[model samples]
Target: MNHLGDAHLRNWTLRLAALLAADTQDQLAWLGERELETKDVVEEVELLCRVSEGLAERGAFEPEDLRDLRAIGRRLGEIDATCRVGLWEYALAVDPAWDDIRSLARQFLLTRLGDWRQPLPRPVRPHTGDH
Candidate 1:
């Protein structure tokens, strides 16, 4: 077993789980607090899609979890296919597809990790330069 690989998997899993855990309103507020944008949220989802390509074989995720993961990815693909490039900002806030993804994420978290009952932690932004 690879500890480094496990750590990497854990980090990305938690990030994807966190992104899915919050609804639009909650996510908006979380990003607002961090001075971040909706693109950042989308970026996280994209990153997860790339990272989890063959993640299940690593033994970090259970079979059911992989099932849910694929479902989430499929819906996300639809969201991407339907949305116009420039319209994502508006869609992220208004699209029902995102809500569907969130629901799937919530279920995954509930059964595998936990529920979204707890408040999310603050995102950490490294200082870029002297303030």
Candidate 2:
């Protein structure tokens, strides 16, 4: 997709994320009432809601959640590259704000998936008397 399209998608993603984080019921009502410009956009919005709901219910995203999101993203990307979802690299290249959103999403996923990179407990060092 072109730069303009990318910008619009990024805006929509941010807006949707905000709505999802704020109040899901209101967001759903808002979506139901609005007339979206395109079917692809509507599909994307619905998909976003589904993903957000799934993540919320699970308390974080699992590997399957990532896979599902990627699959949806790939399908949407076929419609327009900018429509791609769950792609951090593309998001970072297009918009700086996406970094924050992506970071939160990543943390959620990592928490659910188990963060193995955390350091193990170490023994405390004895204090020396010499000053």
Candidate 3:
């Protein structure tokens, strides 16, 4: 891979990592600092499902990463929130029903790349090679 290709791969991992981490309150606050609101986990997790393809193509994902991803997906799938606005939006932060999702996300974030409790890179706009 050339420099640009390598950077592209790196971006995918960071984006995937961010999507996973954004589920937790700590990471949510971190994203807030960068003006990145990744709180709508229903949408973000869906985005992760697609973005992970790029990461997989680049051979950037670990075996455990896929396992953890599926675990998170399965947990979200179990939610039966009765709101058309969106499941995560329906399950507010204080809602006990949302706890499992956040806990799973926090575990995945830490297991895959350590959580926000560790130092993280300053936020960068994901590169799509387009304006």
Best-matching candidate per lDDT:
1
Error of 1 at 37 (Å): 5.6
lDDT value for candidate 2?
0.41
Model 3, range 43-121, lDDT digits (tens) per residue?
Answer: 5665665555556556666667666666766765665544314333334454554566556656666777676244444
Model 3 weakest 10-residue run by lDDT: 82-91
Write the residue-wise lDDT of candidate 2 on 1-131 in tens digits. Answer: 23454445434444443432332243334445343333444365456635544453443434554554454344434444444343333333454343443344344334433431222222224456877
Which regions of candidate 2 deviate over 4 angstroms?
1-46, 51-91, 116-131
Question: Which residue segments of model 1 deviate by more than 4 Å?
Answer: 33-40, 81-89, 118-121, 124-131
Candidate 3 or 2, higher lDDT: 3
TM-score for candidate 1:
0.73
Instruction: State candidate 2's TM-score.
Output: 0.26
lDDT per prediction? 0.66, 0.41, 0.54
Taking every candidate in turn, the Cα RMSD to the unseen true structure, in Å, is: 3.3, 19.5, 6.0
Q: Per-residue lDDT for 1-131 in model 1, tens only? A: 24677668756676667666777777666555344444555666666755665666676677787777777777776755435344344665777887888888888777777675445655677578978
